[model samples]
Target chain A: MNPRDEILNRLQQVQRDETLPPPWQSRRDFPELAARFRQALTAVKGEVHQVDSLAAAYDLTNQLLRQMAAEKVVVNDERPLPNLPRLPHITYHQVGQEDETLRAFCASADAGLTSADAALAETGTVILTSGPGKSRLASLLPPVHIALVPITALTTDLFTWAASFNRQLPANLNFISGPSKTADIEQTMAVGVHGPKRFIVILYA
Target chain B: MSNPSSATMSQFRHSATVAIADIQLQGALTGATNKFVNGRITALTELPHANALRDHFKKIRSATLANLAHYLELFEERATTAGSQIHWAQTGQDAVDIVLNIARQHGVKLVTKSKSMVTEEIHLNAALEANGITPVETDLGEWIIQLAGEPPSHIIGPAIHKTRHQVAELFSKEVGRPLPADDIDGLTAEARRLLRTQFLAAGLGISGGNLAIAETGTLVLVTNEGNGRLVTSAPPVHIAIIGIEKICPDWDAAATWLALLARSATGQPMSIYTTAITGPRRANDPDGPEEVHIILLDNGRSQLAGTPYEEILQCIRCGACLNVCPVYKKAGGHAYGSPYSGPIGAVVTPLLFGLEEYAALPQASTLCGACKDACPARIDLPRMLLQLRQDEVAARLLPWRERKAEEFAAFVLGREGRMNFFTKLGRWGQRPFQHDDGLKLPVNVGDGRTLPSLAPKPFRQLWDEGAVE
Candidate 1:
């Protein structure tokens, strides 16, 4: 059997073991699916405001990164400091073709753009998974990473989140909220010490 | 051959003891953990249904583990479909052997590695070196400890114990010249220059997965410095070693895990770089590894299925428990002397490697229940620790001295009718053992730190004096 068939089979097995009705089978059609999603989105309403369109989100991330740089939150001087501006300098390179993208994006950009899963209003987190075209580094290697948000990807809670997910993703899926950070230092809140200090949700029109 | 592991553990303890007393270590640890704990608190507070979300993940983990075999099979199939090769190892050594074989097949001489604790568990570096291949650590923290020839003290902050001065010194020695003062930028520059060379020179790259999706065979790597990207992309052949239990059945499930992992660890809403490697380079692809191999190691994790400790496998290894653990704060990871250290380590070490070697580890905790509170997957760590302690006692592993103390204490408490007499007598009799501050006289545990002070007055005395209503 192919991978899709195998995944469906396993998911069916889990449903059977849990004695849960097949979620898809129980729903009559698209209307029910839409209703379920509506409920999920409603639950995540408070978190929704935190999500911004891609461009605006990048601005927010850059602002945070610049502030952190000024505060000496991160101590890397080998790379040129990112120059803050109203808009993030956008660059596009095919996933595998570009090696400089990782370095240029890591050292220079405020946030790198990639595709996103539905915007989660509950946590204000944008989801990205690895696959054929999306370079996994585009989401992670920058100072402040942003993803172009898809409206349809929104979920209210974790269960709702799982419902939207394909049982088998190609290789990797990452759910990002805002910025990369660690409290590994003396428990002081230092942004962007190791990863992006700020993460932003970019809602695409 | 000498037992490198035991010797390593001993040396680890020696360094940790020195680190524990170091003001810098204390400052870094206190600062990092408190910020993480407090930030998570604020984030969780902001989420209206945070408790409900925690419950949901618990349900998922329970349900998932119930039919894990099915999940694994599905995951293997999906991963294969994505043009990835998946191999299984029954043990750590088996996992290492598989990785080594892959390295040899590719004619790998020098391997640049991102930090993977799973690889560390099997002593992959030493094993690879013994076989005549060199593995270099690319993460700044991991590289420092690698130079120091020590195990990581803090999982997330591998070099948390090392001061900036020490880092500069290490870098200076490497360059055969005195570097600048202990400045963060200077230190980072030295590391970047050195590791950049290795990244370009490496024949293969090895990494550990933060999460592995069964649905797509995607390997998720969350990093800050962009090192994971390099290690995965720089080399022609890439091998990722992950524990089988790291699997989440689908992207949605994996995303939820990431939500909890990011927030619980370091209080990040999202990690800077969460890399997902799907398969080897596609026909049109330019920069990824030509051959991608993912080695999934069961290594005793499967044995945990259908057991109460099954929840332990749900851990994303965020080190949140370690951060909040009071015992861990004092004793540190080195004192635990296991690859997996802290609260999770206390439970997992005995389970994975056997309790006999790590008998002291479970006893290390004060049953504070902080670990349970800190767990994102909501693993009932305190309860598990208690169960392990009972098992120790049942198995006659509890020290005779402790058993005797318990017996005497039980006798005193059991004789309720004579409690008053003993209470009065004990109060008077314990005077000689009391210190100036009314703490018990200092007695040695294995560690050098002094025991916490005991109370001067028993609660019963205050109650008798009508100090309590």
Candidate 2:
């Protein structure tokens, strides 16, 4: 009778109340967390850019990779764009170099910088996570993603980022929030189907 | 898993009378349920307390279904201590033989799914194409109803009854030429270059859990076409299945059920990927899925736990009661033929299939109450569609002349002088079926619909001339 003990003995003959209720807090307050994360990440087309430091978020990530005429980007090496200023026809590809052609260079890259680990401002979202040198396909398969964040990593939603998790949790986290849409046609929307169609972020401060 | 004779009642009244004489399935079910009821009423009126977060997500789904076997044994012991591999099934052919024996012990030819109404309620792509394996469906409206083999008329727009010239004639017969049917961005860039090489050459990805949590065993998913993050991160074996009533109980009830599931389905305060996962890929993770596997199933949902339709297991499939269903806006979603259609598939496909094959899905609803006011977990669902029409007339399952006209109208409405002698013999037997004032009867009944007439002067003859004290 082991279908997991016949469904835990039919949920222990209908569990009466093993007491659980008491976690849902969110009254939802924002007090301008980066102006409500740039108005919920510019109403989901994303592209925030606030910048006040990290060298003006590395000069708006090299002016949004020369306005997306990108060459071959990639990035995510967990915080190290140091003395940056290269741009001799793009080509970056960082993420801790364990490389086996880093998933076909983040699937034929055209963009995919990174750095966020939190930032919700009531659903503009951007958590990320995945571990060591990041790279969940460098913010997923790239058509343009960017990220950078750190305005003390926002958070006023997804229940204050699952009440700021704990005991070391990263093994694929994500959240994301824009660019890679699809109204499943006839409902219309259509942006990059698989992932990034350009998300950007660069909050800084 | 063959059940699909479109859940009978003469194929739901011949597909609800050909979906009410199809004016393009009533303008694609009134423009996709009026754009998901005006984007779930502008994302729940810009969400601040949104009805106290749907009454705290209906008290976190009725306290996670009353300790659902201690949160599914703490989600199979923290998903087997965060490495995954859980299993369990118990029907729907033991969850399609535990995902076809984990795709025949990982030799899995091609899998790639994602956009799973519990794998279309366990048909599991016709048992993985009758064990030959192939699957595919990478979301763009379940790959336009899996290249038009059909089924999936709409539980989240599964080809919202196909049109864009029938999805450019089912994607020009899956790319063998002739494509442009008003090019929706050239048909989503030819379905993103054919599902990005079937998410980088599938080897098993499956997917289907929208919320499973049990304090960090995790699972989540959501999506908006990153094909649930390339079917849980580009396959190397993933699995998922789900539905032991989507357990919750932690991470603050999976953050109030992901803040009312993409603002009650597609209003999108979220869903452009939510992901989550929590196991199988931890060794300094670079990518994910190094064999995850979840399953859990329990096909009829463990006989719906302390029943009273256990709040229809607090559904979070979030089609928002098929966008405020007026009988799913004129019998659409393929006329509730079931992989869940409107009004929680008319009280969950007749309580998980049977009440004599979905007794015309609780008589296809009209009890209104707009699906418990577009349920976030409000779920009365017209009191479970009047307790499944009193369990389909205590299982006599109607029609003996509609149970003798509902037992002679409940014995003349339980007698007040036989309800005023059948209301003065239905006003003298409907005065020879009055014509211009309305009841043009002579047996056409309701095909053309008029039957109104009975009020002409009989409020008991204007309350015996007191007219209306």
| Top candidate when judged by TM-score against the true structure | 1
What's the TM-score of chain A alone for every prediction? Answer: 0.52, 0.37
Candidate 1: where are CA atoms >4 Å away? A1-205, B1-20, B176-182, B411-469
Question: Could you say which candidate leads in DockQ?
Answer: 2
What is the C-alpha lDDT profile of model 2 across B372-422, one tens digit per residue? Answer: 887888889888888888888888887677788889999999978998878
Question: Model 1, range B68-103, lDDT digits (tens) per residue?
Answer: 666777778877888888887777887888888988
Residue B6 local lDDT, model 1 = 31
Candidate 1, chain A: TM-score against the reference:
0.52
Candidate 2's DockQ: 0.27
TM-score of candidate 2 relative to the true fold: 0.35
TM-score of chain B of 1: 0.88
Clashing pairs in 2: none
Error of 1 at A60 (Å): 16
lDDT (10s digit) by residue, model 2, range A175-196: 8887888897778887888888
Question: What are the per-model DockQ values?
Answer: 0.16, 0.27
Give the CAPRI class of candidate 1. incorrect
Q: What is the TM-score of chain A in candidate 2?
A: 0.37
TM-score of chain B of each: 0.88, 0.39
